[model samples]
Target chain A: MSIDTDDPTVAAAPDPEPDNSLGGIFRAYLAKLRGGEVGSLPAVLGLIALVVVFSSLRPEQFTNSFNFANLIGQSAGVTVLAMGLVFVLLLGEIDLSAGFAGGTCAGVLGVFLTRQEWPLIPALLAALLTGALIGLLIGLLVARLGIPSFVVTLAAFLGLQGVLLTMIGEGGTIPIRNDFINGLNNANLPVWLGWALGLLCIVGYAASTYITDARRRAKNLTVQPLLLWALKTGLLTVVVVAVVGYLSVERSRNPALTSLKGVPVSLVVIVGLLILLTFTLTRTAWGRHVYAVGGNAEAARRAGINVFRVRLSCFILCSTMAAVAGIMIASRTNSVNPNTGGETTLLYAVGAAVIGGTSLFGGKGRVIDAVIGGTVVAVIDNGMGLLDQPQGTVWMVTGLVLLVAASVDALSRRRASATGHV
Target chain B: MSPLLELHGVEKSFGAVQVLRGVDLSVQAGRVTALVGDNGAGKSTLVKGMAGIHLFDAGDYLFEGEPVKVTNPKDAAALGIEVVYQDLALCDNLDVVHNMFLGREMKRLRLVDEDTMEQRARETLDGLSVRTLKSVRTPVASLSGGQRQTVAIARAVLWNSKLVILDEPTAALGVAQTEQVLRLVRRLADRGLGVLLISHNLNDVFEVADDIAVLYLGGMVGQIDAASTTRERVVQAITTGVVPEGGAA
Candidate 1:
């Protein structure tokens, strides 16, 4: 028969029946890890190296409990901004104006809070709405009018800077008086509340991961081994508990205000955003659609996805995240000024995302990239500050790290394309 | 068997250009109807018309003998008509499971049900007797041309479609890969789909097609049974749009 069942090419080699057992899964994972399919490993390793080097060089300063807490605390603004950038970057797009657009959002809120004397909730909403409106305009221009995102956002970058300047006025500063808003970065959760929150996170993570893995196994689908899953869950539990434990230790030298020391408010906010975004990007059909659109727009369209809507939603999300990051920045500094969320802010956000291993060409990235990438940038800045490095030295070193990251991205992409593997 | 899909006297135009004129075509259930033509012979236009990318200006589109109107791809999809374009329509960055269930993802609790979707994707590939893939989790970009084509075909059938129109399925494949895909085409028909196989490869057409329809300059020469026709006559119709008076098409 021309259609022979034994045609070698037609049937190909039966892939070694997948070893679905724990040992087999472990072996497979090891293989992938060796192949550099282990996402975020590089960033984590870099972060660890930075922590060790900095602590050894300036143990008294870098290893201080206050510094450790402050490192995470100060990362909130750029971390959130980078999280937003990850969305756009995954779509193989860029938001050049994200930093200043965030600034504009903060300025709007600051003006309302300090100058217009608006209520906090209403002011907050207006500020967020302004961010969304800017994003909507950018989305329409990019998705509907077919303008390249680079051009549109570059225009936004300059235009939003102007808007921020106008709102705060030239060489002016607007001090945020709302205690609730101002406390966002500086406040710490009560020690008991911090432990409770950590426990909640561990439980939630364990339950969701276990339920989903169990469901997949029940359906006889490919699943990670139980041992591996348990190992991962255990590691997460340890990390969260340790973080809460560390944060709960009093860093205050002041005898009276020592009770105020606990997990910084920004840590909770950052973690919350991380979980929310990770779920959205991984577990939702809309997230899959965004990936498909980024991978191949025509294929997505042929598959009956509304490509325009996906693109628009992605831009809106990027902008909305920037708005949140802006608010965090305002909270941290207790004021909004012309220089807030300027060039370095956007630069660092993009750097953090890319350095943390988010692909510049989209369709492949994770929210966790921002978390890791943000830490790397913050540590570098923090380390240099302790060393009393000149401003030029800090810029030069950050630029170098970003270039290396870009090179890694380009190199890995080339290798992947050459090997025809993800 | 009656034709599952029939287009009667279909006409299409682009400004002053008439791309398809009074073309009549029919495809039966559980059969492969080969659509062949020279370059610029309106083969794509005819397929696009049926795919709902471009609607025929003047035609009666009949499904199971009932006239229907398909204004867009979504409408055609709703009617169980799927077209696998020449590009294969698979996202390179997505894994096989993801690509298989791109837009129509299975959901549980308003979230994508990855387990069910993966199982279904595996089952669909198994049903097609495709064993080349090491895992369904492999990205489409990592797949060979033939495997990608298989993925596209599997995706079309995964939706439980009644009719599948393939445009140049083997055009970019190698000799071995082409044979693999041709075998896959037969398997799809064996599964009882109404298959419209558009191709330029005469050997491929002869190997799998149950019926042959040749197009010449915006007009269909005729639809003839593949088993009863010779290559020379089919070529003659393709090149000149006319079979010798004594020869059967």
Candidate 2:
């Protein structure tokens, strides 16, 4: 009988078995890309292309171990901010105040540390708490009072800038001298410890992949071919080994005076957050509810989900992450000022997310997308600096890139709908 | 046998307009009772009352011969009452399995239990004899209209629901899809559940409904066996707000 038959009896028969071979999986992935589910393919390709072009043009500066580490440090703050924005974007909501919110949180931290003389941990908590309160107010205005998120966050954006300025006394800046706080961006893991962490990441990934597939097999659900899994694991192994190996080489300007080798702690922080957020989005029920609400709020409500709570939590998560990003920025600058988390910070974070393939329309994104896209942004900024390009040129290029990414998002969304995959 | 659900003197009004005026209706287990009416005949208002979207102004809402209060949607759900709205309400971005268990996800160790949910969704679709769908994992956005209706029906029955109220299941479907949905409705009743189908199509009512309940203006005119009455008589009752001469009331 034809599989297309509408006969209930024939239809009730077991579905045609899916092809689980590596070739079959590859073909399916290609089909998905054509259907406008590109995920992070474009961002990854763009990152590689930029790296190649920069290395060819200014190989001495762009490809050095010191610059590589610097790129990671530079991207960490924006990557963390983008990671939080992904949560808001997944709900089809925009948090325009996220940059200034970060600034305000950093100002809070600066005050608690320098003025109150509180220890590091308590000051960090106060900063995070400030972020949460700002988020809660915005969430209430948008989710509960039914104000458009764009307007609410835009208002917060202007208001939070004032809050930050007042906290930092307009023209004043607070210098951070604490060793541990400063070390977040300046310190590096020992070479042995960096190697151990890299291996641990690979092993954890492999174990999770194997265990999930095994469980699916036990339940008689379709699982990807073993070869495909091995290919992915092997690819990750190569990348990890290459990165750790490159960073292990000493890049100290004067070897007799100092030793600078090993992965930056900022990189570690980003990776840890990536793993945690990715797990929350993929493995937990709350994450599933977030996707559902983003996809269709009315349907989610009809299904008995608390639409308001889901929205509120997302705003909270976004701001909390922004606070963490604020900390990273302050650490990198060695001080907190009114401008710490302002001036293209929010723009780059948003660009990073969209360029990485997260739909601004909601219900489609991943935490890893932010990291890949953040790398792209950092590369563009770093490469231009190496070439001695004007600041105006840099802003125009970044704006043009963001415009292109958003256009791609809109066009892909149309294609997805036309192809019945939306 | 006592009816699965029985409403006595149910009256509902909105502001200055009366929508349901002391209406009485009953639905039997192992049978399909089609509620037929014109646009302003209080059909939706009555169904809303039953689903607890709107509380009746005054009424004795009885289920299984016992008076029960259905003040909200949750209350109706507690009584195993499920409504498949005309819009379907399935999230386009989610696959059929996810849509089926949207808010009520099965969880293990604080994580969504995908394995158990997939298995149960597969079994539920199979039990309903649904064949048009190739895979339950397919996103709802990609499914045909008939396939979406099938998923919605399956979701309604998945909860051990005793009463399934369908609001215009075939309203937006083509001929073949309408046939598929009518057959599914027949199967639900055949499985010994009370199926309350609300529709404007006479052909659909004649095809699958075992009993016909006609509403006119704001009152239920008559509830009669489909086999004993003609379509013309039902139409007369719907328009005139009165059972026809020599028609069983």
DockQ each candidate and list the results: 0.51, 0.52
Clashes of 2: 1
Error of 2 at B68 (Å): 0.4
User: Tens digits of per-residue lDDT for model 1 on A44-131?
Assistant: 8888888899999999999888898999877899999999999899889999999998999999999898999999999999989988
In order, candidate lDDTs are 0.87, 0.90
TM-score of each: 0.95, 0.96
What DockQ does candidate 2 score? 0.52
Q: What is the TM-score of chain B in candidate 1?
A: 0.97
Which 10 consecutive positions of candidate 1 chain A have the poorest summed lDDT? A5-14
What lDDT, from 0 to 1, does candidate 1 have?
0.87
Q: Put down candidate 2 lDDT per residue, A339-361, tens digits, no spaces.
A: 98899999899999999888899
What are the interface RMSDs of all the models? 5.6, 4.5
